[model samples]
Target: MLPKKVKKRASLLAITLLVTVIGIFFILKSLNKNILYFKSPTDIKNNQNINFDKKIRVGGMVKKDSLIIKEEEIKFIITDFNNEINISFSGTVPNLFSEEKGVVAEGKLQDKTFFIADRILAKHDENYMPPELKDIMKKNAK
Candidate 1:
């Protein structure tokens, strides 16, 4: 038979462990739902069975000369230096979006080669300059 104090301590320990485990489980579950995986065009091409139902992010450079702006829609291609995927967005894009710049588009893939973007994110470094501006700078410097 265990002493009353010992029995109380054991119960407390067990409750603490159970609570901690439940907390961890809930945290992990929430994180799993919120996490959006980033993939490249090549990855999508290689993995044909990737989940298309869940929202995802695709990151790569915008392919040059692949942008077409219509009255209400914009279409472009994202490339990972190996493969390219066509992306279409019907809303306004970020001001920094341009060809040859790094971009991350969040949405679901319509098919293996096409993506419908819900959001478009353009990322650049602190010292980043647009390619056209950079070219002009180089010519001026020369």
Candidate 2:
């Protein structure tokens, strides 16, 4: 019973709504699969609501005197001053994976603060000083 102009407008609005709904659905689907949560040692220790099976990224300073490199597996401790988490990785480590450096481990948490890492990333400061050393220096300066 509507006029031609009103009918056309209704059709266009329906198509627009359908396209918007489909776009939103796909966007949410992709985000659910690709999103990863980042956690610090303190966060994991203080928060008990974290899911153990979810893949996550943990970042902190590699503990000095805690690195043990075997033929294939490497074990170390990551600390965020307030807490420390033990990590184990069985693969090639970055060239900068050494004592006193900033490292990020990607894996899933096993126990409360234990992470079974599948990949490890190491980063250094601008002066090539290890991140661990930089952290110590900053603390001393303060």
Candidate 3:
């Protein structure tokens, strides 16, 4: 038979191990909930079995001349060169948000082509211009 002290130590160790596992499990589960996967319009177009119910982030450049402002909602198209996804946002957009700017919208996909945005994240830099815009300007300069 194991000594009394050894038995107590083993039981304590087992309890500690179990508690550690449970803690890790809860930590990972919570992290999973907080993780928002980013997808482009092309990715959505290629994935036919996407879960529309889950919240996700869609990143792309705003399509030119696509912004439609209304009293209740703002609508626009996000494009990834090959595909475009329409988005409807019912909140105030950032001041830097405009056509041809990079944007990432967090929302639930209503359908393959439509996204209802809960948040709009416009790409901004200290210089007030992203590299993409610089390239456009360079091209226009040529």
TM-score of each: 0.66, 0.62, 0.63
Badly placed stretches (over 4 Å) of model 1 are 1-37, 126-142
Q: Which stretches of candidate 3 lie over 4 Å from their true place?
A: 1-37, 125-142
Per-candidate Cα lDDT values, in order, are 0.88, 0.87, 0.90
Give the winner by TM-score: 1 or 2.
Answer: 1
Sort every candidate by TM-score, greatest first.
1, 3, 2
Model 3, residue 45: C-alpha shift (Å): 1.0
Per-residue lDDT, model 1, residue 24, is 95
On residues 8-60, what C-alpha lDDT tens digit does candidate 3 reach at each position?
A: 99999999999999999999888973564578888888887888789899989
Model 2 alpha-carbon miss at residue 70, Å: 1.6
Candidate 2 displacement at residue 50 in angstroms: 1.1
Q: Candidate 2: global Cα-lDDT?
A: 0.87
Worst 10-residue stretch by lDDT in candidate 1? 32-41
TM-score of candidate 2 relative to the true fold: 0.62
Error of 1 at 54 (Å): 1.3
Worst 10 residues of 2 by lDDT: 31-40
